[model samples]
Every structure is written in structure tokens, then in C-alpha cells.
Target: MNQQQSLFDVEETIRNSKSQKASEILTPSTRKILQLLTSQRINKVVTASLLDLAGASHEIVQYIVGPIVTQQNGWQQSIPSWVGKAIAVDRLDTALKEIDKGEVGKLASSSEVVALMMPIAFEVPLSSEWTDVYLWASYDALLRHRPFENFKYDKLWEKIGTTPIQYEKIRSDYETLAADIRSRIVKHAAKEGWGKRSSNKNKHPVKATTTESNIQMEQLSLFS
Candidate 1:
């Protein structure tokens, strides 16, 4: 085939794959994870890593075409705008830490001060630029910075590099969205008979506390 013909064929294949419902092929949790991972615009974008995190085995990976994501080399060039915002947030976080330590001299650089101030001056597109998948990733990223339950408002504000009002609004929105996602994942897991699996080693009754812990562990595994 000619180069143009090949390109057209690839596009057509991708479109066909996307037309099919993702639920028909993969579970809700798997589809969500795959979308979140693929939407990440970062260096060393590994297709296999995305698949692995989504719990797709090699055999299942073969059947995943463009529905979950387009397996292409363009992600590196199309870095998400939010990722740049995140870098600025990180810088501000360091500056704030220095300030708290009474190390005012650490932030003496005018350019550094300006760079740090930029995030506060400009509004972050916390709920605007981000899609649901991106929101999921953002929530996970914040969890890495600090667990949500243990997060202090000022700490989160500095970590996000946003004004108090803006931080409050966005933080609430993120929590709401994250809760919804978790609910859906739990429902999907129950739908897939995850709760009803029997232990072959257990001919005896499983303790109630142990079962509850196992359930919690399974939910954690889906995210981990």
C-alpha cells in the first residue's frame, strides 16, 4: 500500500475499535485505569506499563486496539498542559518549605520568586482543562504527595500552589469526583463476582473480620 493508504487504514481501524463499547471487552475498572494511564502525557510513555497497570495480560493486550488508547509515539510531544502546572506547583512547594524553616535567603532569587508567584497570580484549570480520567490521575498524584485523609488545607494549598478559595473549591470537586469513581469501581467489582469468590483452602467458614479485610484488600488492589 502507498504511505497515504497505510495512514488511512490505521485511522479507520482506530475508529472501528473505538465504536465498540469498552465494557464489552474490559471491566469498568480496567477501562478507567487504561484511559487514565494513556491520557498521561509524560516522558518514557510505556504502552506495556499502561496495560500492566490496567491488569491486562499479554493475551488481552493483543485485543486492545484504539478503544482504550491509540498505541502511538505522539504522547511525548503532546504533553498535558496540567503537567507544566504541576511543575510550578512543585517549585512553590519547595519555596514554601524554605520559608517555613526561616530560610528567607533560600528564596532570594527574583526570578524564582516571580516563578513561584505565577501560580498564585494565575488560576489553575483544576476542573476545566482536566477530564474525568485526568482528574483520577490528579487525585492519585496528590495521594502520592500525601494521603487525602491526612492532608492539611495549607499543605494541600501549597502543594497545589493555589489561593485558599480556589484550593477549597477544587479540592472539594476532586474529592467528590474521586468518591464517585470509587463507588463505580466497587459496583463493577461486585458485578464481576469478585465478592463471591470462594477459597479452595477454606472448607470451613471464613471469619467475618477476615472477609471484610479481604474485601478491603481487593478494593485496594484495584487501585494499587
Candidate 2:
């Protein structure tokens, strides 16, 4: 069949991945198969049962028809289906973490942050081009620097998964997102006054009565 036919269900797969938190919730086998199914080099020829194993039991179509993502006007090529699923999951999870206000303590359940988080947890749309445009803008800004001209999102994510820096600035530059996350987490925790500090229950006892040495001296005097 043609490439178009193979990718017919790409949208549905992406929707399920987002709704089910496939990145965080799917069985490992399902996740692996989902990732494999997105490849351009895999010949797009998996059977329907394979997709079922990847958690798409509803799909009964036998063959992969074509590319999963429809080509957009300005895009040089079709964005990979897995890319949207994974990124949407990331954005949703991050927003949820922020709304939980560092951790789920009593504060989290009733805090302003939860109210804040409940609204934005899944607010980011998978088709939102804002992030992609930002990444492209970031690459453009860094292009003047050596080794950064080769910046690409896949390379950036790959390096983030590895030791980061080898031949490009992708590692250091990409990790700014991690730093931002940490900063936000700290901010949330601080907002609720929720970090480690000496509690009154754990404080040192005050010097009560007299010292052991003083007590011994008093006993000796009495004996004397």
C-alpha cells in the first residue's frame, strides 16, 4: 500500500499516548514497540497485532499504510508521530509537577498551586508549534557559535539522554530546560514553605537541673 495508507492511524496513536500518559504508564514492551513503529527506516510494515501489543487493540487494520504525521505547509517534512506523543506527555507531566507544588503534602492538596496545576496539567496541545518554533529560534541564536550550527531537536534529546557533550553545544544548552525545571520546583516548594529545616521536635534538649559533674560534687560533699 501507499505511504499515506500506512500512517492513517498515527493521529489516534498520538491521542492515546497523550490520554494514557503512555510515556509514564505504558508497559515497557508497549513503549518500545511504539517507539519502533515511528521509524522512517522500519519500512512501515508491522501487522495490526503488533500495534495491539503496543496498546492499540482497537485497531484491526493489517498493514502500516504510510507516514504517521500529515505534512504541514511550512514544515520541511512530516513530524514523527512518536515525537508529538512523547513531547505532549512531557509538557503535561511537567505542568502537573509544578501544580503539585514540589511534593504532595497537606499543602499540595489545598494550595494555590494545585488550583493552578489542575487547569494547566494537560493544557498543552500536541499540535502546538510554539515549542518547535522556540527550538528553531534557539538554534538560530546559537548558530554563530562553533558546533551549534548543527543543532537539531533529535540530537539534543539524544545527548540529554547520554553524557551530553561530545561534539556539540547541545548538551549544555539543552540542559537549561532541566535547570528551569529545578528552579520552578524550588519556587513551588518555597511558596509552600516545604523544605528541610530543624523541627522543634528534633531540637537539642536544654540544660535541665545540674550537670553530672555538679551532682557528683554535691554527693561527695554530702558524704564528706
Candidate 3:
């Protein structure tokens, strides 16, 4: 009798947990931000960062979104400061040297430049310290529509010559990267104990806050 009662208690607890989750509500600010993501009005992974920052002080949101918002509104800017943010700086330098030696002859387009860069960029493990620095530098360059932003392009031009790729192609590539980075962010959140996995194998658990769960649902509705 006691054993049967214990199993019933466990089932009851799980039911209550599921009920709580199903009843979660979205705050107004979170709902607005999620609408932006769902409608594809703001299509970068930075929108996920904004979802993370929502419900914090207004100043924090402004500080985080100011430059991106400005760029969205037709103000062109380059993040020149991302020049040397790589952990494996030597790796990139060596790749440049190899290119100079004609290891790959005439990188005719930005996609080829990215092909050369991909291996060197990911040589460091994504779980290793400072990995996000490298990832963000890569993501930001694409976000700013400057695929060659991290390279010493003047020096590169002198070596492999000018490699121009279409803006539409770059945008398509950015969409793929954004999807990848969104997955990484969720896994990282789980590692940090801010998220819990659901019973559904396909769904990733998000942080158990009103805003976070709402954001997660919005992402899932659009993506999954």
C-alpha cells in the first residue's frame, strides 16, 4: 500500500509541475520583444540577447541595444574594435601567411575568405574559455554586413587581391549562423542552471521566468 501511495505522490508532483509550466504568462515588455523575433522584424541572435536582458532596468536595455537599434535605423557603422578579439590570434595570422604563399589561390569572393577562416576560427573548442569572444566577433562582423571585418583587409588585398561577395549571400549565411548561435545560447543557459529540459525530447527548456519562458515559446513557435 505504501509503495503504491509513493508512486501516486510522485505522479502528482509531476502533474503540478506541468500545470505550472503550462500556465506561465508573458510580461508586456517580454511579449513585445518576442513579437519582434517571431515576425522577423529583428532577425539577428542579438534579439535573443535582448530577450535575456528584458525586465532589467531600462538603462541596461538601452546600453545593450543602442548601437544595434541605430544600425537598424539606417545608420551604417563598423565595429573596428573587433579587430583582434580572437583567442587564437596566431592561428588566423598563420592562415593569412598561408594565403600569402598561395596555399589557396585568389580568394575570389567573401565566401572563400570565410571558407579559409572557418577552420581557424573553430580550432578552439566552443566550451573553452573565451569561446564566445571569438563567436561574437564572427557574429558581429556578419551582423554589420562586413564579412571581412576581422581581417586586415588592406594587407589581404595586397596578397590574395580583392574578394567581393554579394550582400544577399552574406545575409543568407548570417541566417544560418544565427540559428546555430541560438541553440548554443540555450545549451549554455542549461549548463548555467537557469534552464530545465522538458519531457518533450524535441523541446529545450528555458529559464523559468515569466519573460524567459515567454521568449522561449515565441522562439519555438517560430522555429519548431
- Which digits, one per residue and each the tens of the lDDT, describe model 3 over residues 101-212? 4342111122212322343344424442233333333443444344354666445323433344334545544445443433433344444333222221233222222121
Candidate 3's clash total is 0
All candidates' TM-scores?
A: 0.23, 0.20, 0.25
Please say which candidate is ahead in lDDT: 1 or 3: 1
Off by over 4 Å in 3: 1-160, 195-224
lDDT of every model, 2 decimals: 0.31, 0.29, 0.30
RMSD of candidate 3 to the truth, in angstroms, is: 19.9
Model 1 TM-score relative to the real fold: 0.23
Candidate that scores best on TM-score = 3
Model 3 whole-model lDDT (C-alpha atoms): 0.30
lDDT at 70, model 1: 12
Give the per-residue lDDT of model 1 (tens digit) for 135-170.
334443454344246567446545655433333434
Listed per candidate, the RMSD to the true structure in angstroms reads 21.1, 27.3, 19.9
Residue 215, candidate 3: alpha-carbon lDDT: 15
The positional error of residue 87 in candidate 1, measured at the CA in angstroms, is 21
**Residue 80 in model 3: shift from native, Å?**
12
